[model samples]
Target: MPRGKQTDTKLTLVSQFFYPDTSANANVLSELAVGLEERGFDVSVVTGQPAYAPNDRRDDQPRREMYKGVAVRRIFSTRFDKNESTVKRMANDVVFFLSAFLHLLFKRDEMGVLLLPTAPPFLPILGWMLSRVRGYEYVPVVLDLYPDMAVELDYLSEDGVVYRVWDQLNKRAYQAASLTVTIGETMEETLTEKYGPCETAVVHNWEDGSVIQPKEKANNEFSRKHDLVDPTTILYSGNHGMHHDLESVVEAAATLEDSREEDLQFQFIGEGGRKVTLVRMTKDRDLDSVSFLPYQPVEQLPESLTSGDIALVSMQEGVEGLCVSSKFYTAIASGQAILAIANEETEIARIVEEVNCGIRVDPKRPGQIVSAIEHWLDNPDEMRAMGERARSVFEERYEKEEAIDRYATVLRRVTT
Candidate 1:
């Protein structure tokens, strides 16, 4: 790994968040940086200060630091500000795009390869702009598709100026990049169909030494302390945004409020834009069956996950092809059964149905969710079998070791 060797190639990874950000994209890019470095690439990451996870925060740290032998350069960003409005978040993305675009321009000539794992959706444009400089091969590792996804989540209008501009830029960026990578096969297929087979690839995200499956204590301190002594626990952790329409879960909870399913509780863990309204609705209805827990630390993930009998992984009605909740992978690794809330045709639903991995309910239907929960509770053998199936699916497709090996190979092949 000597510097300036004939075979030595410097690769730069750009993202909005890095190591300390607990989001899926941040975790994926951090691992990619470390993985590529180990594979003998001169890996350098350019990211904004972490606004979400403390570990990803870089505002107080120096502009640059060596992270696990990878050189990480933090670009200035305003996302670190607390309680950002929707407008503020959009503005933050704009600022990061400009700052990151400038940084890439400055280093364009030095990098043999440039990788951006979904941070600012504007990155494809920035990457294309930087690739205009000689000697830079822009590699876009897409964690999620924008415009389409944003529209699905109601973040942007389908025909809005922003969407129209981004759509064109994204297509051009896809055409311009040396390779475009995604987190799973479904996304690979989706991107392939959309852009007509540019060098797109799949590399799922993984957990590192920083995170451990939380030990599922028979009694989670949060559950016990909060007196959530339900007969069955269905836990959903991560952002509770519009993307996570809790209406179905709420409706199911209401339907089962008078039922004797003592352990059947729905616990939501994590913060998001819709949290306030969601919580208010829950409180208004006196839904004691539902409880909210603040997201726990990585060290406590195993225990946090163990708090529930079942794990809930869901998405908005659409964007099924474009995004898979990385949280579902974590639940699988935790060896928990999943009650997937998504479209029937999605890879997630396919895995759940094909493997019988817990439950698959149209998240739009509370009655269906209630029935699924009741069925699982009434048939413990069936439920436990689904848990086993979920774990098998993880070992077969989403295991970190396998995913990282694929990524390592991609880094080499694209650069070679």
Candidate 2:
């Protein structure tokens, strides 16, 4: 832990998002950088200006700053609107890619290891290209599988030339990495099948128990503000993006409109492309039991998360292995029972079963979803037990300290 020895163990984390940004990726990378810095490793982050806020930017912010003993260098990139057109988004990605490439190229000697996540989806390729000559250990963290996600979402055809080219690049990136890190075993399995065997680690994303813990709704600000006091709240809080199957939840609400108890409610907090559709469906079906709320600030996350009786975690049909919901960990830490609307065989479902934290209902089955919620409502004791078990398992396995240490260990192993 000497200063001189620490200088030789420098780590450079490259991502499009970082602290002061509200994105989940930003939070994850920020925590990792700070944790690594505390462990006596010289850590620096190469990121872009604050741009994740929809249609906003801090144009006057400085390009460089020191945050909590970690060196943060923000690159100059196009400050396009966060919800811009596809061409504009790609341009933004290109600008960051070029700017980050230059920074890493010049500072390659000092960076003993590079941790790059697939934010822009071009970063792994950039690192793979540089590692050929730079000789720095490249560790690619697979947050979401590219090209496959696009194809699954119908943005690109699997048989198209673009898909084929991107798939090949993705393969090369995984192949070049000294160690590939993904959040769940399902994602790791998908990567293995797609690119053949590679050195990979399945480190689940974690939550800070102190930051997001159980709180009584009567004392919770979010619950009181939103009048979420009486109902047994079924909360879906996070990005309602294309990767999630929120329609099933809406259908479940409509199905139980008359049969559900008067005190039962479904709350959707957050915004994305699918949110509009969800809102329309609720109104068109005259589902009075449903309520929509904008995403709460991070400071309010604890109260908002704990306001729910059961937290809903969902994934679209084909998106099982492509991405894991980070909200799942936070929901567990919130001490709420989990109702996962995904494949029963998925990693999230497996965790729910192993911990006895909640139930799994396939998103394609609205009846099953309704039944699961109703069953939980009928058995309050079982629900309370599940919530208790959720917090216990979270502290034992998904706490921030342990997960970050595991990540540090993986980086150390690959570099040494």
Candidate 3:
């Protein structure tokens, strides 16, 4: 690299995943890499092989490549079929954390700015080990506090040995970070309670407008191929896993069954641990009002979402405030109304209410979900108002321009 204006700050974004993967960590980190580079930072990335997105497992490919302007080093990791066994997934996490730590250990001699965020929650352990051995500038981004939130959500048991170990790693990662940034107010608050507000700051999420736009027609020949449509379409696109516990969604569909008077249709498009079970629940109950499909690329989101009259964002029981779904920003930017099903007290619930862009149904109450969806579908005028509100919220809070600027400012703050 030449000695440019950014020569003073040869920053490297470190994670176990990057772009070409549709996960939120990949999308956010990719944007951060490009944005920081544009803001006069000599940027590169140190990551693992493409362990996710567009691929079911860790791909057998070259160890390194460049995407656009970012220099990337893809280290080796245990093969992980994201769609496969839970044991394999855990093993992948262990390997990814160790490999990333080793990669950073070698980089520490010349490290400038190291940006480490979550994918495998223990990446911070790598950040800590690398920084302590050879002190380097680091900005720890906490997407979620492992074992803390996960344990709270019951994704991991409170007293599990792994959770206990991760709880220590979580504290150490925070203790070592020069500055910390989080994606939601709830997370910011949580960090404050632990680390105090001095070093941590709230940089709530924003949209990647580059890949998202108003695709008037979904253009999904698959929808046509399947012949699925109705009076109104309410689509939920993202993880359909255990944490999502989509039973209430199915129950809502069943509750609305007798009313057959309303033609509202629920479309679930994504993959997860709970998907098969969700499908079975919907099947055994014979709920004809809902449909399911596989995940798609981020680029296809606008088309997929705008194809419907409304978009849906839901949190499973006991999972509220654990994390914010990146899809909320996408759905908002799509200029579509969102029916957010979440606890009435969480950050997501606050967003839906503040945006006034859609209804907020008690996610635990299947009956309430049914009633809210019905009322929204039954009123076109209100729906249009909700869409406009949705767009307004996106422009004010979630647009790419705004988000990039926020990140750039934070980069300068932590690096300088």
Give TM-scores for every candidate, taking all chains together and pairing residue i with residue i.
0.91, 0.95, 0.91
Tens digits of per-residue lDDT, candidate 1, 1-416, equal: 33232354678888887877877667767877787677667788888777874334444656789999988888888864333466777777889989987776766557668887667766777878776754467888787788788888777898799899888888888988888888778888888787775887777776542244433444567556555544577888887766776777887887898776465678888877767777887898898888887767766665676666788888778887777787778777666788888888776788778887878888688888888888887887887777777677777877666677787677777776
Candidates 1 and 3 compared: the better one by lDDT is 1
The models' CA-based lDDT, in order, is 0.75, 0.84, 0.72
Report the number of the highest-TM-score candidate. Answer: 2
Model 2 lDDT on a 0 to 1 scale? 0.84
For every model shown, the clashing-pair count is 17, 0, 0
Write one digit per residue (lDDT tens) for candidate 2, span 194-268: 999789998888888989899888898889888888888899998788888899899988988888655878999
Best by lDDT: 2
Off by over 4 Å in 1: 1-6, 53-59, 80-84, 208-216, 219-230
| Better-scoring candidate (lDDT), 1 or 2 | 2
Worst 10 residues of 1 by lDDT: 208-217
Query: Candidate 3: what lDDT?
Result: 0.72
- Residue 86 of model 2: what lDDT? 64
Error of 3 at 302 (Å): 3.2
